[model samples]
Target: MRIARWTVTDLIHDGFVIDDRVVEFPDGLTVADVLARGLSATGELYERVRDAAATPLADIRLLAPLVPAAVRDFVAFEEHVEGVSAGVEGKSDVAPEWYEAPTFYFTNPHTILGPDEPVSPPVTERLDFELELAAVIGAAPGVGQANLTAGDAASVIFGYTIMNDWSARDLQGREMKVRLGPAKGKDFGMSLGPWIVTADELAPYLDADGFLAVRAEVYVNDELVGEDLVSNMGWPFPELVAYASRNSCVVPGDVLGSGTVGNGGCLGELWGRNGSLTPPPLQTGDIVRMVVEGVGELVGAVGAHVAAPQLPRARTRTRARRR
Candidate 1:
């Protein structure tokens, strides 16, 4: 039940990975598209696709599991909050309100980059990485189209995927100084996928009491930079989604990121106040790899960007148009 979107022979389709075998789903396949058909259909679809022929996974290029209608990231991890708080001006213990409610930031869905793609650092020089998990919404009544609930959020969730919230520390600091959340500091480059692991298929990894125990780790150029336990999150993923969907609506293929995952998650959050520094920023040849226990890893290389030739400025027109 590890659902994925991939391209082979120059055609893209929804697929599921079943033990070294590649099975194709129907056209325009999406997590919600499968989920809406119910568990019986899900199993049947897997069987139908698997019965075809097994293809080597490496031969196909994996795309983001879902083509999201929208994307948001939540600050739900306690360790991440505490770690970042300690480094901030005067914040310390977790905010009282944070425990009572979920907080999130809307991210540009178009900014999402796929695995093995090169990520160019933005204008700011202090580029950093955040290891996170994204809940990929499957199908849910009303939610994908209108009102949503915590349980609905769970139902809407098709599966999970690893996320990298690439950050610009300097720009982030400058923007947050005005007391607003990140804008330019983020949004430029965020990475997800290799593949999406469906929730039911990943059930074994879920604890006996119905919880996930995935470990998150991030590496830069094969050097371990950060490690954290997903269980350290303050508010659970369901609540994060429910709270985010209260008045607003979430739809199929929407993504909700579990912000940064605790210590070593980000260099600025980890070293900004300690007067220490982290490994060098990624260069054209460097590689970044992020792993989650249940889900697969996302590997990408840094590549050079060619400067586009300057274009002439257009003259501003103030005259009324003639019909």
Candidate 2:
């Protein structure tokens, strides 16, 4: 089953997408409400409205699935890390610490966009996209919650969605040199949607190692630039979530992304493979799309570029510090 947050004319709703129709949940039933009720609520709710009238899929506007309580993107794929380190940071190998535990950084959940939205590039020089998958907190129904171990991370997973961690390479590479951020460089824009595919739906694709054997691909202006298997992650989703929930609580709505996939998953990673200079950054009007087997796709357009504006004197730090 799929859960979608969408708008039909003037009516906004969180509902089930069955066949070519949308059967909205009753009033006050927000994404948070359904999440709190666990995975079973989706089926139960759908059963209640199976015969009810639903809006056609093409008539509604899909919004960012839900505003997460928090969002953390983990570097769970070694191929992605090794490639990015070599290309972006000029490191020939990933740091040893990466193998020890799941590492991640929080991103702005407030700027999340849904399918078909326009994304304004923070920097036109090196705007890029990361193909990823996000695991929302809480298992479907009939599961344990607190004190989750990597062994049980699968039990608590609510569902999964595709993610496009939009980035400004120039801003990111510059700030990361100070050993601090990918914050301003990131956090400005991201895309998440098509809809959430429940964990139960993906069980059939799970390999013996627990990794889902799903294909992930990225396209620009309808051109297929990269593709990789979702099962290729060195550290699976469970381990990443298990590490995230350690001692601390990971409640409903909290999201953890699978980070970028293998080489060429992003333009920067692709540069690492070309044996040459980086490709041209995204220009206004470019369409970036990500497709994950079973999880659907995310599409966004590059909005017209805006020039950086002069800011208050107190904020001169952005330009004042000389390297």
Number of the top-ranking candidate, with TM-score as the measure: 2
Worst 10 residues of 1 by lDDT: 272-281
lDDT of each model, Cα atoms only?
0.75, 0.82
For model 2, name the residue pairs that clash.
139-156
RMSD of each: 4.6, 3.9
What C-alpha lDDT does candidate 2 achieve relative to the native structure? 0.82
How far does residue 4 in candidate 1 sit from its true spot (Å)?
1.5
Choose the strongest candidate by lDDT: 2
CA displacement after TM-score superposition, residue 177 of candidate 1 (Å): 2.1
- Tens digits of lDDT, candidate 2, 1-323: 88889987767799888878888887659777887788876678778887888889988999888789889998788888777777766665888998888789999989998899998766457888899988987544323345577777776788999999998888898889889988878978889998888888998989999998899999999988779998888777888887887777677888899989885788887776564456666788899988999988899999976667756654435665677
Worst window of 10 by summed lDDT in candidate 2: 138-147
In model 1, pairs of residues that clash are: 32-138, 138-156, 144-251
lDDT of 1 at 134: 87
